[model samples]
Target: MKKVTVYLSENTYDVLNNLSSKRKESMSLIARKILEKGLTEEAAKDGIDAVTDAVRRAMRDILKPTEDRLAKLAAKAAVAAATAMYLNTQCIADLGKNNALELYQIARTKAVAYLREKDEEA
Candidate 1:
């Protein structure tokens, strides 16, 4: 065993000596106990840190696929919205050139028919 000396205050020495007498133990035994316990706890902390890092990396990797999928979905939605707006504007221009009332009545009839068909399917 490697022997090393550590300087302590008189009060600290008294405390350790008193504790040794109370527990019927030696100062070296107390120091060894403290060292072994600290090392074990440090080893556990290292293991926890390693697992935490691995989990963080895994979560990032798992979410990468979902992130890519969401980006694609957002792009598709943007294109669809733009197309819908263009079509609506075009239809409005066409209606202005034609009969507005006629267009509205035709749209209303088609919407009602589509809803009825959906209800029947359900």
Candidate 2:
């Protein structure tokens, strides 16, 4: 762990203090938790990455790319990522991990679908 000094406004400090009291957590711990949650939320809300991905896909697809390009990319990326995971048995050790992978696949599928929807509008 590392110690760093951060200055917070009076209003923000008060909110943190109140939430810390409600959660029965120390102020420092509460602050760390809040920072982590904010990062996670920001990542979830990020549209720039999605926009960039869509633009690239649109460019490639527009360039008379081979068939199944999106599906091929998704399949390769998923298999590469999954092959890196170390599991002892054939069964999943944790359902959350599997769900996360599944969620990624669904998100990719939806992104392509939405991209096509947007293109139709344009």
lDDT of 1 at 36: 87
Please give me the total number of clashing residue pairs in predicted model 1: 0
| Regions of candidate 1 where Cα sits further than 4 Å from its true position | 9-14, 97-122
Candidate 1 lDDT trough over 10 residues, lowest sum: 95-104
lDDT of each: 0.84, 0.76
Candidate RMSDs in Å, in order, are 7.8, 26.1
Candidate 1 structure quality by residue, lDDT tens digits, 23-118: 999998987787789999999999999999999999999999999999999999989977975676578777665565566568768967886785
TM-score, every prediction:
0.66, 0.41
Error of 2 at 106 (Å): 57
Clashes of each: 0, 0
lDDT per residue (tens digit) for residues 1-122 in model 2: 89979999999999999998899999999899888899898897687789889999898788655557777898999887666543322233355455655655676689678867845545
